[model samples]
Target chain A: AQSVTQLDSHVSVSEGTPVLLRCNYSSSYSPSLFWYVQHPNKGLQLLLKYTSAATLVKGINGFEAEFKKSETSFHLTKPSAHMSDAAEYFCVATKGRDDKIIFGKGTRLHILP
Target chain B: SQTIHQWPATLVQPVGSPLSLECTVEGTSNPNLYWYRQAAGRGLQLLFYSVGIGQISSEVPQNLSASRPQDRQFILSSKKLLLSDSGFYLCAWSASRDSPLHFGNGTRLTVT
Candidate 1:
C-alpha cells in the first residue's frame, strides 16, 4: 500500500520567513507524489507533483518540493511565508498512473504577521 | 482549461432525508471522476470513482452511493442522511491515470 505521513500537524512561521512542511511516503514501487493546499471551506488545489521526472519540482504561489528517494521524503518549501499562505497542506501518494491515491492527515500552516 | 463544478455549496438537512449532490466537468471528455469526503480536521476519504458512464467503483462501505450518468457527470446520493454523513464533500476529475486531480469548491453537508 502507498501512504503518506505529514510530520507536523501544525506549523507556525513569521511573515517573510522560510517555511517547511515535511512529508514521508511508503510505497512498494516507484510512486507519484503530490502536494495540495486547501483553504477554509474550500476544495484542494494541487501545488506540485513528482513523477520521477525531476527531484526538484516548482509549483504555483512560490512553492516547491524536492523528492528524495533515499529519504523517502518529499518536503514542501517556500522562500518566504505570506499571510495568504495560511492554509491546510496535504501530501498525497499513488502507486502509478490510474491508481488510487492516498492522502496524509494534513498540516495546518499559520503565518504570523 | 478544465473545470469541475459541484452544486449546493452548503446544505443543511434533517436526519432521514434523502441526499443528492451533483458534479460536472467542463472542457474534458471521458474523464475519471471521484467522490471524496473530508471530516472536520481530517484527511480526505475516497468514497467512489468512475471510469466511464454506468461504471462506478466504491472504495468504502457506507450509507452513500455514487452514479455516473454521463461522461463528465458524477452524482453522490444517499437514501437517508445520517449525522455521521455531515462533512465536506468534494468532486474531482483527472484526464488520465498520470494526470493530477482538479477539485471543485466542495459541498458542506450538515446533517441535523
Candidate 2:
C-alpha cells in the first residue's frame, strides 16, 4: 500500500522566516512524490514533483523539496515565508501513473506578519 | 492546455433528496478522471476514477457512485443524500500515467 504521513497538522511562522512541512511515505516501488498547495476557495495547485530525477527539486514560488529515499521522506521547504504562502499543504505519493495517488492529512500553514 | 470544470459551485439538499455532481474536461482526450471528497479540516479521499467511457472504478465502498458516459464527462450520483455526504467534492484529470492531476474549483455539498 502507498501512503503519506504529514508530521504537522498546523505550522506557524513569522514573515521572512524559513518554513518546513515534513512528510514521510511508504511504497513498495520507486514512487513519484508531490507537494500541492490549496488556497482559500481555490483548487489545489501543484507546487513540485519528484519523479526519480534529482534528489533536490525546486518548484514554483521559491519552494523546494528533497526526496530522501533512505529515510522515506519528502519534506517541503521555503527559504522565506510570505503571507500568501499561508495555506493548506498536502504531501502525495503514487506507485506509478496508473496507480492511485495517496494524499497526506495535510498541514495548514499560518504566516504571521 | 487542459481545464476541468465542476458544478454547481455549492449545493444544499435534504437528506432524502437525490444528489448529482457533474464534471467535464476540455482540451484533452482519453484522460483519466477522478472524484475526491474532503471532509471538514481533512485531507482528500479518492472516491472514484475512470480511464475511459463507461469505465468507472470505485476506490472505496460508499453510498455514492460515479459514471463516465462521455470521454470527458464524469458524474457523481447518490440515490439519497446523507448528512455524512456533506463535504467538498473535487473533480480532477491527468493526461497520462505518472502525470500530476489537475483539479477543478470543486463543489461544496451540504446535506441537511
Q: Against the unseen true structure, what C-alpha lDDT does each candidate score?
A: 0.94, 0.92
Model 2 bad stretches (over 4 Å): none
Task: Give a tens-digit lDDT track for model 2, residues A64-84.
Answer: 999998999999999999999
Q: Write the per-residue lDDT of candidate 1 for residues B17-44, one digit (tens) a residue.
A: 9999999999989998999999998899
DockQ of each: 0.75, 0.67
Per-residue lDDT of B1-112 in model 2, one digit per residue for the tens? 7888999999999998999999999999999999999988999999999999999999999999999999999999999888999999999998765788899999989999
Clash-forming residue pairs, model 1: A98-B97
